[model samples]
Target: MEKQFSGQNQKKLGLSQFVQAIEASRTLAITTKVTELRRQGKTIIDLGAGEPDFPTPAPVCDAGIQAIRNGKTKYTHNAGILELREKIAAFVNKYGGQYQPEQILVSAGAKQSIFNALLAVCDPDDEVLVISPYWTSYPQQVKMARATPVFLQASERDHYKVTAEQLSKAITPKTKLLMFNSPSNPTGATYTKDELAAIADVVAQHDIYLLSDEIYMQLVYDGLEPVSMAMFPQIRSQLILVNGLSKSHAMTGWRVGYLAAELPIVKAAAKVQSHSTSNITSISQYAAVAAFELAETELQKMRTTFAERRDFVTQRLRSMPGVSLSLPQGAFYVYPNFSQYFGKKYQQKTLNAALDIADFLIDAAGVAVVPGEAFGSNENIRISYANSMENLAIAMDQIEVALKKLQ
Candidate 1:
């Protein structure tokens, strides 16, 4: 017999199939473990974090405080406040996006902007091309939108950059979008203009949208300038460029991000957001305005610091025996192939996957890194250099010493 509606006899409501299919974030799991260890009075050097270790620039903080003083705490327009949108338009224009205030949608973060764009464009049977060694959220978000994430796996030999040929071959009739990231997360593989142009030529031939995630464009090093898919006029109608202040301005807690696209796409994303998060915090929007107005000198200081750390981490990793990675040009993480040590054993547990490497590091060296499996690869683990040099040096030294102990 069917169960009657009673708290005692009622069957448990099951979780959504869609959500059940999504994998829990391994990075967040590692973060939780690190937090617990710290709570237990353990000293853990966490290189797993994706956010900047730098504090938010002072003027930006002042802007938020000023916003509060002005009582500007009401819900903003769904597309964002006009002033912030205008400033964002100017910034987007500099990156080759000919966007107007009406063409932008500011969401909770670049993440939400991407999610909104995915929901706006992807149908149930649609396929989204994701680059492997990807940001952890890409495939999960695609799946959450009921779209299949088809990976275009780039080889470490290619510096983890997807080629035009690979992209051309990956596109099918069901392909609805391509998620392109430059100065990529986890790998820090930034593509050059020539590579981008060749990729653009392929996308131009297809009836697909390009959701370009350039959140780390401002953090590039090695005399590298930022390039954008918006720079390609051929795909302008099909382009959705997402950027946020979280990474660039050390405003992760502030939750401000935006997308620049065609008017219809922006309108659709606004519709999606209106049902979910509406606008981001009004205070943060005002602060984001000041974020754009931040002095170049302030940004340069952080960039220079990150560049030094990147160099230090790169040199350290390359010097380790059996460790190798392409020199990362941007972003703050170094992903070194630790697959060479996969079969090595610790006390009793055998190292097998990237997750094992991450776990073993925490136990052996008190170092916490995000496993490469979190980013759709298991041959390596991601070590973010978004920490102070002193901490970074200590972490690297501990890591090297710990590696020698594995047999």
Candidate 2:
């Protein structure tokens, strides 16, 4: 029954409890707040961006332009253009998975690809295992599909990597899927091949599926080899491999991402996508084929630059007194504990959580960062080094000074 408003005959519509209970993405939330702050004539150094600082590769950009000139603006297949799927299949196969174009489903972004996979495999009330300090989207997407999210916390002592023992212990009859991200967001921790294999073995014994999010597969540093969940053939049949060109190819705005999974899962996700978004933009699909074809050249250049910036950020953070963090293996973010300053005062207010520190940084230090509470922890904050080296150096310097003033 709809209730009438207090002095009117009109009745306001209500929202579903599930939707009402959902929290907005804290990463994007901070980005929005930073934009608002900068609009007020305040100098703000934004290190909270989630995408690469580099531009999309030249070949990929040319491909998109060509597609537009060739009048390829109309919609294509619901699953995406055949040529793009073939390239995605070949790309995933190159990374250790045996895939065919029939199993690939292209979507708007890696975000949608993951959500499609979740909606395809999950039933109402099913539980999804989300390792903590996870991407802010995981649990929200799980809930959007009516699945309960079961969070397993990874300790900083382990470099935030979960072990096979923990994976085995977390599974239950109610668990329908495991959302695994390596070169994970927020923490930037990547698992080794042997470590992934052990966890894959545990999943192999269960009836659940593993949705490996390898969005950051191309960003590892410090002489580490990239490992995909698809590398382990034992779990291949049950693996739902998710990856895209956004991070590796710097095509965040192009909106091209795909999942290589079993045919049934692909078909199911395609059906869900069909009613919702239909095919992704035609020009973007054309460019994605180019991105896959031009593999390592442009990406290597960006990766090298990011590696240098990572080194600088790591060294600066380590020298700060009372600060501690795992050496991030890949991706562009650093999750560092700032709990030592929790009881310190800024103005007349005490810093009680990561949110407070984030607030203090933006207001006092002119820097923007996402609080750890956004990633399921309150003792740390995530600083994305996806900015210019000069900006990063200044941000770090200001962060250090602002932190020292907590007393």
Candidate 3:
């Protein structure tokens, strides 16, 4: 006979097992800790944020206010306001690909667009090939959608960008999708037209869906143009182009993101979003229209500033001893490999991983950085130059002094 379970002997209630599979974002965790330390009167230089330091363009903000004043705050179409979608379609179609308003789904943010894409297509056991060091949310989103994340390391030797040959070898029968990011989060590596063409060929051959996260598309520096996977018309059916005004317009708080896919994919993703978040904020949708139209000049100014900061930060990090990194082609981050310091010690603490190094820098240098382990690389750490040059210079100096003490 089986023994009866009593209420006291039963397991305590907690988050669902499915939800528990996803871990809290290490980037956000570090940022929050730094914020708390700063509030406590600690002098902390934060370099962990992924957002631009610039403010949202005045015209875009004014559009939102105007919309509110006009009472354009009602519920929008579940797929998004038609006007915004049409503009998004036009903007995307300006490139090599073709898109229609009906094929676009505007969501709360690019983050939600990504989640909806995965949830719409992936089944419980499907596998998503994630290129590391990926944005930290990729794996968690895959898990939350009941899919498995398969990592293919984009090694530092290759400038942290995966090759088509590697992609071909990694694909299995279980692989249903690939999460692709250019001007990538941690390494800032962008793919050229030739590189994208090669990868597109592989993706087409495998018949797998490609989710191209181009949130940082307009942030590329050095006049390097990032090739969109959607440009390959042969594989357009397999492409889900994800983008937002967050990074491009410094509208991180606006929560405006969208995806352009084929009609079937758009409908499926919109269904997922409709059941969950419904339409994005109506005011944000209106603001995004102005963002696309009136913010280009201001956006260019922000880009110029980021380019300057990127150059300054990259040069400074390269000059530091035992630090090595490829010059990022785009995005505002410099991911420096600090593995050379791994067996060193400071006081009683042994630095064996990037996390340990991050902790050391925060405590000793009063600088906050996201550890490379969070991006699936143990040999490197990510530093964002999205702050003012004055703060960045001071942070780098503190990091230099802290690193020296490790020996």
Q: Estimate candidate 2's alpha-carbon lDDT, on a 0 to 1 scale.
A: 0.91
Better of 1 and 2 by lDDT: 1
**Deviation in Å, model 1, residue 373 alpha carbon:** 0.6
The digit string of per-residue lDDT tens for model 2 on 1-407 reads 77644532324555556667799988889889998998898899998889988888888899999999999999899999999999988878887989999899999999999999999999998999999989999999999999999999999999999999998999999999998999999999999888888999999999999999999998999888778898788898899999998998889999988888989999999999999999999999999988888857677888899999999998999999988999999999999999988899999889999999899999989999999998999999999998899999999999899888878
TM-score of predicted structure 2: 0.97
lDDT of predicted model 1: 0.92
TM-score per model over all chains: 0.97, 0.97, 0.96
**Candidate 3 wrong stretches, greater than 4 Å:** 1-12
Cα lDDT for residue 172, model 3?
95
Provide the lDDT at 224 for model 3. 83
Query: Evaluated with lDDT, which candidate comes out highest?
Result: 1
Stretches of candidate 2 off by over 4 Å are: 1-12
* Model 1, C-alpha of 13: deviation from truth (Å): 1.4
Clash totals in order: 0, 0, 0
In the predicted model 1, the residue pairs found to clash are: none
Candidate 3 local lDDT, residue 205 = 95
